[model samples]
Target: MAVSLTASGAAPQPDDAATELRARVERFVRTRVIPQESVLDAGGPAAGAALRELRSLARTEGLWALPLPAELGGGGLPFSVYAQLAEAEGASDHGPAALGSATLLDVTMLARHAGTRVRERYLEPLVSGEIRTCYAMTEADVPGTDPLLTGTRGGYAADGGWRITGRKWFTSGAGAADLVTVLARTSGAPGDREGLSLLLVPTDSPGFRIVRELPVLGAAGQYEIELDDVRVPGDHLIGEAGRALAVAGERLALGRTLRCLRWLGQAQRAFDLMCARAATRSGSRGALADHQLVQQHVFDALLALRTTRPLVHEAVALIAAGQDARTEVGLAKVAAARMLQQVTDSAIQVHGAAGLGPDTPLPALFRGGRAARILDGPDELHITTVARRILRDYGPQAVTPG
Candidate 1:
């Protein structure tokens, strides 16, 4: 309701509603969500119970799905305003999922491209936290950098439905998902970008099977799965046939931008931890904060956080305005990811061996920081792609933003 902001990421001055929403999210995450993060990380009946209770509390407190469409039972905050709150909501890895904003990308994609029947069946439940979904695009041995080499194939079945056969790995939350949005080649040959399409496949489909758990750096979330002729209705196709890349590209741009913002939140969390440790913990030379080396860590972490915030918010602004944001998003993605790793690493150093242990969240934060660089198109990919795009304009007209 009445969402407004000053320069997107800058501190809000006049928007009471926006500021209030942000404060509420920060308070909820710091007080309610962060406390239960360890329980959620442990993964068991208690974790599940804690998560359900937290989700219930989120709804009770009116903090659920603030970034989704109001018609779909969310608070309907625009991207610009939500971008600010995203930092707060993203302080914890579980924040978005707990508050329901985790569905933003999928919901946006489905709302724009999915058929009426598919939307009617899934959107409401997804937003209300009644069901969970995951995206499947990467293949077992194929490099994820090129979607044109997708090994998954979807073809028409004798029953007039679509049959999908593929092997996918690194599918996050696949083990517990009720549905999965799969990318498959419908008519394209190898190395051809055309003919790829997105399909909505129910996890309960007759031929769908989970092969194994893919633990990233020893964490339990991603999975490897096999779809052996899993079939779905004709209307389950997302967007136009042969245009999945365009649809996916749109989703990915926003998804990457959102991720950058979340990384900033996480970096800030790490920075806070580092500062607290530096101020209180003492060595033979006195408090850690009093040392020049420790102060350098604080200064460098602060500089990174400050510099990366504007780049991220610039990308957010472009996306909110529905403009080309590839350049901005690419820059933000790499910057925010590295910042997270740097800040978290510094934080771990300040804590000494204690950071590696499970006593605090530093170990998990550091792990995620390392993983962030590789996920959602690695830092190398973004750097090279953005550089290439910028260079191509030098031969002719000057470069324009994308």
Candidate 2:
């Protein structure tokens, strides 16, 4: 999966097939997916129907699961190439789910770490979109900033199984997920990093239940779930015992990188909307585009989009080649999140009253933009972590002794 770079250290241009696939995905998102945003916004049975229809169309169009493995009914595109398509596919929030790439993180993690039985049972159906999954790590009372604070407990059952008991909130898609990958303390006490383990618990398990819907900005999907001694066989473990954080670290790295690319795509969408609004909407003097302040918005949004893209792609390159890219991914994640918020806010400004209304997608995009800052690690955490990592590179000689 090594990528070839030019003399200037830039990645080589994508081949024709990759370029063609990207174009097809862009067109699909623009045409088929964008039109259904209103339905998705509404939520409920109609939205579910629309999503299923979109997924069927994606399959019929030969664009389903482009980033997953071909043997498992995916396009098998490499991350380096799929990174480009991810931006396009991510333009609509529902794009990844509809096209089957939504399972990339879970599928990849399970394929590499899950035991044979777990893989045999879940992998193919997951790839084919027959079932759904969600990751549960954050808890109701704990600061998600630290994984070492996880309080969920998983103990050995009398019959060589495991019994899990804990309550996890803000678990996205928990209502619809067939399986939830839960992080539990297997041996050590809270704050001990050596004892955490991941257990794959089926939603239909005896004691697993969704407590309530935890909405974000009046949107539904996130839920508070409780596992009251939920039991699963011993083989349900993901990766080695007491090494859940290590497995989670790898998963989050790729997940964050994908989120960065998707945020850029959403920002680009907002930028386009802003420019279109500026050029056409007549104000007191002339079209909004004539205003110097409006011009500044255009310039700033374009600058942020263009500049942030390279940082994201840099992270993508390193990740595709299986290299350490913590700094690059952190930089991309923060930059893209801020860029989306800024660009979407500017777009809302241009549209004025209409942007705040439900008629346009600006409000929904804005909500996602704002949440992007908090999800997948907050901006402050990334800023702090990235700084510490960079400083460590300078070693002892660069450190000043007090």
Indicate the residue-level lDDT of 106 in model 2.
96
Give each model a TM-score: 0.96, 0.96
Evaluate candidate 2 by giving its C-alpha RMSD to the native, one decimal: 2.2
Clashing pairs in 2: none
Instruction: Show the colliding residue pairs in model 1.
Output: 326-402
- Candidate 2 lDDT tens digits, 164-246: 99999899899999999999999988899799999999999999999999888877789999999999999999999999999
Q: In candidate 1, where is summed lDDT lowest over 10 consecutive residues?
A: 5-14
- Total clashing residue pairs per candidate? 1, 0
Q: After superposition, which runs of candidate 1 have C-alpha atoms over 4 Å from their true positions? A: 1-14, 396-402
Give the TM-score (vs. native) of candidate 1.
0.96
